[model samples]
Target: MITKDIQVNCSIVERFNSLDSSGRLAHAYLFVGPAYIGKTETALSIAKMFCCEEKPTAGQLFCGQCSSCKKADSSCHPDINFINSDFGEQIKIEQIRELLAQVRLRPFMAKKKIFIIKNVENITLEGSNALLKTLEEPVGDSLLILTTSVPEKNLDTIRSRCQIVRFLSETKQDLAEHIRTHYKEDEITSQYFAYFAEGCFGKARLLQEKKWFEKKNEIIDGFLFKGWNDDSIKKVLEDKEQVKEVLDVLLSCIRDCMLIKHGIGQNSLINVDRKEDLKGFADRFSFDELVAINGEIIKTCKLLSENLNLKIPISVIKEML
Candidate 1:
């Protein structure tokens, strides 16, 4: 689905439009960026544009009323295919073979068949080799779009074959403002999603849908402020998904305390709702101590990303306090 506000990813669409207008569209494209940053959405939008029966010009977007647009929007378009890979699982060679076979056929309806492979970095080396054959030989009336959060994991040959498009992340403030204005969110709600989502609108929307912001006070007060007790850590660790959320909140709280120590304006603080409490916490530590704590928190977060044992990192964080 096209996101509610797509201005953040308009550059990709504009580039595609220019290419389509000039009749110079590439056979394959690689859209690389952080997860939930609109790479897939942009690919889907471009796919719809390619199939739009209205035949929009360079400056115009797809007409929603067209049969092709309706089918694409409803995910019923035969010519548009989305191949999704689950987390931690590599795309199989059989999947690549199926994709190759499908791409060999002519479009069922539209002028071109579009295949969007999400998380292409997860493709196994064998699968990558199979996919490479198709990329080497341009298939008839087909467009291949591959997306990956970690471009470094993708094969260099595959990367070289496609026209690479790099997506930039939005600023926290800009995202907060967008959420507040477009979603009719309150200032705190808007700021919460923006900070937690790390400037990704799609992530913000998912967090909102999950009502994750409701846990803000509980998480901060329970584990963060009191220096992550055994019970608090246990609760957080029980749900592996919440591990990152807890770390993000802990990092933000520490940063807020640092800001409070420096007498920074309240508006600059991420956890603005807890300004008074953070100020009190800040007074207990020296500036250098806070810096050290911040470093530990950053280190722990990195270790967690690498799938290291969380207990070791948590123990180190506990010692920091």
Candidate 2:
């Protein structure tokens, strides 16, 4: 049901247009960036362009009204195959074999066959080996597009075979504008979410969709006023999937407190809505205590990354409090 009407960065669009117009488009492209940063959308846009029935005029890449564009937009194009980890966390070798067989054939409708592989980092060693052969010698007029949030996880050979296009996170101004126009939020609220997102529009959108501000405020109130305890830790750890987000919010609150203690302006703080609460916390904890706690939180994050038991880090966080 998803569509590809969302506009990507203008610079990326221009770059692709230049390559396509010059007839220098690479057979393989690796789109690397953080999650929800339009890596897949960009790849799909290119695929749509390749399959578009009508030629695009200057400054326009694809005609969205064309039949080819409609098919690509709806993800129903015969020549465009989307491979991902829908079956499991790791893309298995069986899927790779099937893909190989399909790519060997010619396009059914479009000028070229486009294969979009999402989360290439999750491809197993066997699958990567299988894909290596295809990448080494791509079939006639076929295009391969791979997208990954963690490019480092992909094999060096795979990285070498593809033309890497790095996608940077959105700027604060861009993110704030998107939020204001899409989410109908005020300037201050939009800016706060923009800063909190750390230039990732996808993260900002997810936070808005999840109604994260209310939950973040509750967590901050409990941590600062109610104090840390076993129950408090349990509440934070209730959803293991959201642990990182919760930790990020907690870290931002700590940063706001530190900024307030140092006489920094409220505008510089991400938790601007809770400036009064931050001021109180700033007065309650010494600068040294705040620094030590911040260090512990960072350590906890590292431990979590290392796959250590979640409880261990949560307990350590409690002790720091």
Candidate 3:
């Protein structure tokens, strides 16, 4: 019932299949991993397996032809509930209360009531407490699945009640092949996307669709190459929402320069397309300087996320550069 024909985590799939075969699936599960690695999709697939009208066999996870599978694929299944933050805000206690109320009821059409909470790390303290109550006294024929990129941010009590499933990031080769297959891009371009994505498929796809590399090039040309100055830093920091992404790109560029300084192969560099420029830039800074700059960029990113004054970090980075 997973509509997206993308590659899933085989280990998790095998685990789910084994659980299905033995009928020993847990009441609560936590899918923890980096962003864009398809934790939500895996959760949905499990939901489909639970709700499918035609019982899936060992090999076949879900019978896509069934009515339940169809509904699940379209996210219209009555029993499958998805809870997420509203408008980039935290999931409130009221939302958790409503979910708890609904979970107490029996399934309308499916065999079980499945609740999938996305960005579980964003659950407020009160909401976490409300969810914890349900976790402690699990309802019959009910499944709770929580997905989070930042599992460390989740409350310990909530995390302890669920069966944790760790999802590792995809390999660059696998991600590149996925891009080549789905986006119809050539191997070189796909590899480029894969390198910059840092093992995140969703980020690779977004970069491809949005032409983010072009934007990255503009930033690099104006800020890094043209020279690190007040105007260039100001231009990069203008869009607070994009500051993290800009910093990531800058980090990649600096990483590439370090690689060049250490005489590493260009094939392993994230900024493969700009090897010459990176090489030239590498000469200007010592290896220690590159490492220090990378650290500074990371610190700036952390500061920006804390809602600190944007100019403060930018100024620090300017001085570092």
Model 1: colliding residue pairs: none
Task: Please write out the lDDT profile of model 1 over residues 49-89, one tens digit for every residue.
Answer: 78888966545667667899989988889999888886567
Q: What is the number of residue pairs that collide in model 1? A: 0
Tens digit of per-residue lDDT, candidate 3, span 117-231: 9989889899998899788887987989998888889999989999999888778998898889988988768887888787878778779888976888886786577766777
User: Against the true structure, what is each candidate's TM-score?
Assistant: 0.90, 0.91, 0.86
- Mark the regions of model 3 whose C-alpha exceeds 4 Å error after superposition: 1-4, 55-58, 86-88, 226-233, 285-299, 310-321
Each model's number of backbone clashes? 0, 0, 0
Which stretch of 10 consecutive residues in model 1 shows the poorest summed lDDT? Answer: 1-10
lDDT of 2 by residue, 24-124 (tens): 98888898988877777777877887788887775677778888888987889999999855323889899989889988898999888999999899999
Ranked candidates, highest lDDT first: 1, 3, 2
lDDT against the true structure, each candidate: 0.84, 0.81, 0.82
Q: Which residue pairs collide, candidate 2? A: none
| lDDT for model 2 | 0.81
Off by over 4 Å in 1: 1-8, 55-59, 224-229, 315-321
